[model samples]
Target: MRIVVLGAGESGSGAAVLAKVKGFEVFVSDMSAIKDKYKELLAKYDISWEENQHTKELILNADEVIKSPGIPNTAPIIRELEELGTPIISEIEFAGRYTNATMVCITGSNGKTTTTSLIYHIFQSAGLNVGLAGNIGRSLALQVAEENHDYYVIELSSFQLDNMYNFRANIAVLMNITPDHLDRYDHNMQNYVDAKFRITQNQTPEDAFIFWNDDPIIKRELDKHGIQAHLYPFAAMKEQGAIAYVEDNEVVINEPIAFNMEQEKLALTGTHNLYNSLAAGLSANLAGITKEDIRKALSDFKGVEHRLEKVARVRGIEFINDSKATNVNSCWYALQSMPTKTVLIVGGTDKGNDYTEIADLVREKCRGLVFLGVDNSKLHTFFDSFGLPIVDVKSMKDAVAEAYKMAEKGDTVLLSPCCASFDLFKNYEDRGNQFKEYVRKL
Candidate 1:
């Protein structure tokens, strides 16, 4: 079979490697320059690849196409492939075909990285042979091709779930659905919601589906979808028959195996993290992890980078790097966790963000706002009535400096953009790293 992999990034390169290992004639193509590491991997495997342009003839002749999640369905090439009746799938979908491992897949607009990492940590601590893949770790296809394990904890995005058809998770976790990445979904909330629901599409009675029961969107949609997996609903409020819930300041898991832990004992704080901890604990219990192991993992997990990560304190001002907070909902979580007044560094590629979600939090928690992006007009217009000091900056260093100037003793400087990082940084990680580097110089 002829397989064409698009984008030549981590996912695309990994898919090409897996396709080659499965005896498929593989070709990798990327319209942008392929990274040096990926190019070396393709060369080591003797796979043919091209960068900076796509040869339509080569791509059109493929028997199958594995697309990177970053590629939109509206791309001309994708539309052409669709019109030609060629099957295009995500790398996850392609990798699932070759692995019989138990898949623990997670999807949501927020907290996916934290939840995926927490679950993987729990399983690893329990001595389970697990591969951490998807959005948080190495590519799923790469792991399946080389270091195949008995289980995989995968963090999926809506884009990935869109192309997945026959792939089903042994354990599927839907954290919550918020308005996110709507541009790719034709500005339709239901479309994005439907895409997230795909995580449980091919499950059976033996599989388990864990989700946030309190999210009105999930609650309203759950009854409409005919999911075959056993439902495990988690919430901050105690429900009569919930699989997981908070009771008397303790988090309780009632299904598969009963376990309870003081809410304060969880390493992650804030209401958002409470939901994350509950979901991770429920997943661990469903996977047969011991209650003792789950408690230990939940308490000791260091949390994902760039999400409420504390940087060094400079002259008593706390600095937090929440560069992963790329949406208003994520920013709201960050702000909600602030114990002190904050000098918020925000702004980036807008992504059609609705600032109203975080408006109350901003007005209450933030003493000032430092805008960091190519343009700050939208932010200025939205925050004009906040009556707080606002500064506009074009670089991470400038933003950090402005935040420090606005911050005082007992104040916190938080870098939670509430927008995509493409305007000023290569990605969220880069934005976060630079924030730390600049904070250290203070």
Candidate 2:
């Protein structure tokens, strides 16, 4: 069968390679230029591919299509495929069909990257033969084609979850749902919520569903959706039906294995991280990792790069790089963790964010604001009247310099954009690296 993969980025190229290895007639098409590295890999695999255009005549003949998560169904090519009733699936879904590896899938609006990394770290420390895939590590399709592992820990975004139908996770983790990527869902909150809920689809009673019990969004959604998986709810405080909870200054778990650790001993700090630790601990425990292994790994595991990564402190001022905070909710968490007044650098490609969510936090914690993006009118409209020291900067260099000038001793210079970095930089990693590089020079 002819399997056409759309958007030959990391996931799409990996999917194309996997399809080729499986003896399918594989083709890759990208509207934009395919990276040189990927082009070489595709050619090495002897896979037929195209770039700079999506030829309908070639794409229309596909028996199935593997779509990159970045490509929306609203794209003309995808719409045409839909009109033809052609089956389209995500790389994760297509890879799932070929592997029976135990899947520990994670999804949430915020904290997923850190949590996913934490879980993988714990598993690795325990000496389990595992592979980290999905949004963070290597592509799941690529790993499935090349590597052999007993387990795979994947970070699933709502976009990846959208096209997934029959793929089942042995242990599915829904960290917490929040308003994210609403633009792709026609600006309807429920549509986005439904897309996230897809992570739990096809899960049976034998499977495990872990989530934050305190998240009102997750709670409300749970009431509406009937999840077949054995629910393992986690929370900050002990709830009625919670399996993992903090009590007496300790993280405790009641089911799937009784485990407890001093909360203060966790390597990751702050309330959000406590929740992350609990979720990671529960997931690791459920994966049959010993308590000693889980405890050691949880305390020793370092954090994710772009999410709340700390930069150098020059001239008694701390600079934090939270470039992974692409939404208002994520910024709220970053600001909440600040122990001192912050000169917050924010703005990029706005995703219909409601700044009101972090308005109070900004007022309380931020000494000043530096808007960094090509456009800043929306940020100005919401924050201009707040009477805080605000600066509009189209470039990261100006944003950092202005923030450093505005900061005083014991104050923080935080680069939490709260919007995508596509406007100025390549991606979040580039945005974060630039912030670090510029801050280092100060």
Candidate 3:
């Protein structure tokens, strides 16, 4: 069989290599120029590929196509592929068909990476042979091609979930869904929520669905579409029969098995992370991981890059790089986690943001606001009524320095841009690395 892979980036290139390893005739094509590193890999594998253009003649002859999550379904080429009755699937779906491993898929607007990592840490601590892939590290296709594992902990984005149809998750986690990437969903909240809900699309009664019980959006959706999987809801407040709940300072998970621990001792704090920890704990319990291992992993897991990461304490000023908080909801969580007065460095490529959701939190926690994007007019218009000190800066370094100057000794400099980094940086990682580099210069 012949396979065509679209978008010659990490996901696409990984898919091409895996297809070749599986003895399929693989051809890769990208509308944009392919990087030298990936080009070299294609050469090493003796796979055929082209960059800067897409040849319909070659792509149409394929048995199937593996598309990168970054490419939207509305692209002309994709539409053409669809018109031709070609089956195009995501890297995650393509990879899943090749493995019998128990899949633990995590998806939501925010906290997905942290929860996926926490679950992976718990399983690893239990000495389980598990592979971490999808959105975080290596592509799932590449991992499924080279290594054999008993389980996989995958971080699923809405884009990735869009192309997945028949893939089933033995354990599925839905963190709180909020308005994120609405542009891809025609600026509709239900459309975006439906994309996140796709993680549970193919699950059965035997599978487990873990969710945040406190998120009203999730509850509303659950009421609309009753799930077939066993429901496990985790919440900060007490719930009558929830599998996971917090009482006083301790978190308790009942049902299939009972496990309880102190909330204050959790490695990740804040109400947002409390939900993340709860989701992870419930997933670990379902996997038969011992409570001791879960407790150790939850207490010792450091964190992922660019998401509420503590950079350094220079001159008694704490600098935090939360560049992964790309959407307004993510920034709200970051702001909610701050303990002292914050010099908030926000603003980037706006994704139809509703800043009003975090307006009250800003009024309560922020000392000064630093807008770090090309355009700050919308932000100014929104927060002007709040009557806070706001400064507009052109670069990350300027923003950091300005924030540092405005901040007191006990204050925090938070680089939690509640928007995409495409305006000034390649991606969130570049934005986060620049923030860390600027902070280290202090």
* Candidates' C-alpha lDDT: 0.93, 0.92, 0.91
Which of the two, 2 or 3, has more TM-score?
Answer: 2
Q: In model 2, what lDDT does residue 180 have? A: 79
Q: Tens-digit lDDT track for model 3 on 336-361?
A: 88899998999999988999889999
CA RMSD of each candidate after superposition:
0.9, 0.8, 1.4
How do these models rank on lDDT, best leading? 1, 2, 3
List model 1 lDDT by residue over 1-442, tens digit each: 8999999988999999999999999999999999999999999899999999989999999889999999999999999999999999999999999999999999999999999999999999999999999887999999999986999999999999999999989999999988889878888889999999999898999999999988889989987779999999998988755789998998999999889999888998889999999999999999899999999999999988999999989899999999999988999889999999999999999877889999998888999999999999999999988899998899999999999999999999999999999987899999999999999998
Candidate 1 Cα errors over 4 Å, as ranges? none
**Tens digits of lDDT, candidate 2, 17-45:** 99999999999999999999999989999
Over 4 Å off in model 2, which ranges?
none
Q: How well does candidate 3 score on lDDT at residue 289?
A: 89
Q: Is candidate 1 or candidate 3 better by TM-score?
A: 1
